[model samples]
Target: MKKIVRLISAVICFFQLNVQAEEPKEYTFAINSAVTPLLHAAFINETIKTVERSVAPAKLKVLYVELPELERLIENHQTDFFISTAATIRRYQDLGARDVLTASSPFSKNPNRSEGSLFIVKEGRSDINSISDLKDKRAAAGRPTAFGMYLAAMGEIAADGYDPKTFFKSTQFYGLNRDQIIKDVLDGKADVGILRACYLEDAVNRKVVTTDQLKFINLKNDPEHICLHSTRLYPNWSFGSNPSVPPAVLSAVAAGLIAQKPVGIGLYWSVASDFTAIDNLLKSLQLGSYQRFSKEWFWQRIIEYRFWVLGTLAAFALLLIHSFIVSRTVNIRTQELKESLKRESQSFHEAQEAHRRLMKMQRAAVVGQISSLIAHELNQPLAGIKLYARTLQRAKDSGTLTEDKLGTALAEIRTDADLAAAIVERVRSYAKGARSERVSSEVSELVNKAVREFKRQSGERVEVKLTQAQPVHVIVNPLEFELVIINLLRNAAQALQELGVSNPKVDLTIRRSDNSAMITIEDNGHIEKETIAKLSEPTNSTKADGLGLGLQIVRSIIENHGGKISFSQATSGGLRVEIRLPVQEETK
Candidate 1:
């Protein structure tokens, strides 16, 4: 039985070798700094697992290169797969590298495509509270070319009141690898070290550094991820493949990376990496990481730095010239403004007096025009009172009055007196010329009330139509709104009566928009163009015996309520007046 088992194993190994020969004979992958050591280890492990599943021993080669070298390798077809920061992926694509998969660290997983730089130190070290404390102390950073590592550290060093170069007794680039720099800091080879955020995970797992020994210093807690990080974070590395490779190979590689533990990197796959911000950073740094800076700009900067002192002096001289020109222009304008102000101040008092006189005249004009209507309005309830009294006397004389009949008579008497009091109150208020008391009131109610009052007073032959988009509640003076509507309707009714139109019509409409309310009152009458023009003009009455004061009063009331009024010809041969008022914002 043992011999048979050994033979079967031997047969399986031979077939696997034969199958591996049939598969793609060769393939290579690239690794860089942003990819953690664990990811690298996992990728190799998963690759082996994938080969086993496929029943083949396909030989896979791995190449570890710094970010810049990786770019050259992919473009040259020296590697089949490349891993880089998202920014680098765009740079590589522009440089002829194909993007396949985006790699993520388990520590900084989904939704966060890139990690920032972290400044770690021994926990109990009091000598270094911040980057500034690193003065005269040795500092180590992972790869000067690795933007996240050094750029972030430099910014912190500057912010902590220390120049990155002058702040340290000695600063050195600790190889283009994170693990090496982490070890250097842990082994006491460096006083300060900057590492990518996720690199600490590996050091902790490997027992190379403990949380207590390595402390993250000057940690920034930022919203918008702009934490007061001792160092800024650049975009995370991307898992990509070389486009020069066959599509089949790219598919297999992408599939392998995406599959769970496909080769040995943890469960990580392609995700969208927005590197626009990082690109902006790289453009500022002028790093040759990409063609973001053209050769012309690079040479121009090189020349400028050579003569920076002279250039700065020249720029200062031009600034002074601009300042002198602006100062002269401002002085000239100031004098002209002073002269204009003197002339305007002489007319301010005159303007105020004229405004007061005009308001008084307007009030008198409205009172005259509505005198008959006001008398009629009051006469209605008084006449009802007289009729009710006569009926009550007749009933009492006929000996038909009972307790219920007397109660009814008293209630009718009270209603007639109340009606008379309201008409007097409205007239008195209008004559007082006091500003309308504004509050939130339903527009439809105000319009309907005005129509009812007009019909009661005039009893003119007219058709009234009221339409509202919705029950519009506006911040307004109830009295003022009612007054305006009444004036508009009365004007419309008068125009119809004058035209001798028996079936005259008045239409009231209210429209509500996002920020304002519009009220329109339209009438069907054969009004001449001259009459329409004179409607709103003060003292320009179109009626032979009319005061021409109704519309003017309406305009005043609406304007006082923070509104505007205008008149236009309706499409069906009539006058249309529209009033717009701002809707006060609702209190939360």
Candidate 2:
């Protein structure tokens, strides 16, 4: 009986072992069709090995399909695990999927994320160095669903000031693999090609292509971790578990992926990276879940939140009313300001014309005063000439006119006649008011001439001294400047003679200061302080015989030549007149 029981227990144990072996736990993994068939197989095999090791003694069944099918599977809770690009991963995450791990590429700058797309053209293709250069050029890329290659490439192109949809002459999507796009670029079928970063390196390592055959477009230097990339880095392919997955299994799978060594060429699995940038890219492109929540979707949401919508509408209406009121007010003020400016401009022009006429009248008054002085100066010479003529006639009639006497009388008559002519000529030139051209002239020369003319005209016994420290040259209208000096000197001599000083003296000094020439004329004569103050004013004179126009005209002429004239009490006595004129740069 005991032997019979042992046989039955052995038979039951064999059956139990067979049943357990035949019915191992099963987990479904879905992979998108972004990779080639062979690559897809390899990826699946690798994932199976990882999951088998993690959940010991359990089996994993992977279903390879396109992105749309995988998305459906995730939504339907039919997929326990999913491996795909960031965009699809974000869709899965939105459906309550937990991130398991993210794949790390050998060319990634960070192990936690994948590098961006790479733009390339054949060697000697100089015309395709930049995205703008790609305009009207044939280009190739992976499928539009590829985030790391096609979408990323489009993002980079748009960032470089080009519309991806319209910039290129033609854009061809070479299925879901990068190899065909690269081949198209190399074979001259396409002018430019874009692929995920490190694809070229992989091809080169595999001996399928040479680096010398192609040029990288928009290649950026990244010292932190070397790679060829153009767009911003994003989280790499993600492996996530569906919400129905058990917590224990998910924990075990995460631990297993973290423990696995790099498969090849520094490719490994790591803790899932942040998907924020990937979500932003999808939103920007209006893809995946973001596609449904577009501008129209936003309006729907606003309708759902009716209170917020009403508040926004009310605020917008108020803003429009305020803007209208402010614009009207601004327009009214602008018109008023324009009218005011027009009136001000008209007043300014009228004032300018009036000032010009007043200057002309003042000049005429000055000419009148100078004419009087010239007539007075010519009177003596005329009288002398007449007396000499009478003497010569008398000598001839008395028969006492010797040849020597006749010669002496004739010479005296000629001398007086020449003096009268010179006075008349001087007056004529002054009255003409010729606009003399400005030229560089020595200030000392002008002062000496004025002093000599003053003595000759007034016949006053005033001691005049000129002190010049150095030669000073000024830019001036010589004729007008000389008149200015003459007027000042004549006034000084006249004042000295009127004061009746025992030893009347005048001193003229010239010196250079910086870029200016200074002339000072001082006299030793009694003059009141009030007289000095009013010296430059028109028709204001201290002397009973003075017209006071001399000093005023002198001031005007000096000012017109960009010079200044001032009067001060002399250190010794009388008045001191100081004139400052701009010196010529060449002379300095």
Candidate 3:
């Protein structure tokens, strides 16, 4: 009896092991050929990564299937899940396959249905002006069944008065690979080649073919061609889960695919794809048939007569109300326009008078600000002349008829006089009311020159620093840019003088980064927080001496150069002013 019991227990254990082995532990999925990029991104990378993170590294088999193979997989119940176009999913649903998730295509980001096909030829080839011209030309296509190559091309050809069966002399179809077709065209193996519309941009950007090597022809002008398109955009792809898939697994797959992101494609997720257009195309060509939805009629009746009638009536009412409102607005606008015309002439004259007075005030203020500097500049030459004259008198008094030495002394005197004349000339140049000169200048050189000139005139007490030493180049009106620097320096000098700082210093710094140039001036003047707040607020200077138009003019000049200025307190207890200027990219 004990032996018999042991035998039964062993048999029971063997049966239990068989049951566990037979349980389903693997799943299979197929990628629709149209959505290969998305397949690689989501399933191959993201889905497996997600499963690895949660469950142990169980090998998941993924199969790629074309449309026909996908249909067969469903018929034989070989696939656990599948991804396909919206129309195909609808057809499967009609044939009793339930949708678990909706699939989206790569081109679904752009809502405007713009798309088109291309007909390209080799460099300088002008024999073909239209698709009808391909009657006897050899053409190569990336994919014969591709929406762009076959459907879009056929639609264009039919419009151009040609039938696909007899239009071209010969046609060669390759699976979806553009590199092969491009190579074939470049080698003169094919008279014509076809590509998706925007596909050429990527090729040109990557230097696959020089722009001169390719010529595009026969673009359709439909609304669908006006927006994101290449060779007549067909509907996008659809993703769906298997009907036998558990809800939890279906939800997980949808979440995983939506979360997948690999570069180039921006924030992506599945959206409802409108395949009615593709369905219509297929029906027209009798390439495939779609079964009608059973509840489609119920929804169709509610929309056809009920929703559309109400919408039409509502739109008509809105149009009438809009017209009435517009008529009333037009009458009011006419009266307002007459009143505006009466005021325009008076306003123009007043504006001109104001502008004239403002210009006079500006000139007076600028002259006043530089009065001391101009006097100092003049005094240098006068002082030199005085010294030379004294020397000549001494030489004459002690001379033993030294004519050669006296002549040398006279030449020295003449040199000092010429130096005075040069100062006068510089003043004249500044005083003259002429347009500034425009020139191309290296940025580092300009900043260095400006700082040296400031230091030479203003004395050694002012410390200048050019923190950023990168060389930037620009085309600018030199006089205008120089004037801007001078004005800023003058303001900084005045700020230091007002604070009565002994080591009165102004620092000039230059910087270049990315696509811009920056010049900064820091002065050892303790500007109050309150004062700094009101600096750019158009407040006049608190000084009792002259008008505070220096900062205002500096702002205008920098703005004209496409630069901006900002003020802040320096860490070393002074005022800091930064000017940022944009660097223009040179075109080759």
Q: Point out where model 2 deviates above 4 Å.
A: 1-25, 33-46, 53-58, 66-69, 295-588
Ranking by lDDT: 2, 1, 3
**Number of backbone clashes in candidate 1:** 16
lDDT of predicted model 2 = 0.73
Q: Write the per-residue lDDT of candidate 3 for residues 350-442, one digit (tens) a residue.
A: 999999999878766655544434454445446656776787788777774377876876776676576456545544654564444556677
Give the TM-score of each candidate.
0.43, 0.43, 0.38
Clashing pairs in 2: none
| lDDT digits (tens) for residues 225-330 of candidate 2 | 4557877777777778888766666766765565555664455667655677777667667665675567866877878999988999999999999999999999
lDDT of 1 by residue, 429-494 (tens): 768985545788878888888788677556677899988998777888775576578667877887
**Model 1: how far residue 581 lies from native, Å:** 16
Rank the models by TM-score, top first.
2, 1, 3
Q: Would you give me the overall lDDT of model 3?
A: 0.61
Native-to-model Cα distance after best TM-score fit, residue 555 in candidate 2, in Å:
81
Cα error of candidate 2 at position 36, Å: 7.8
Of 1 and 3, which scores higher on TM-score?
1
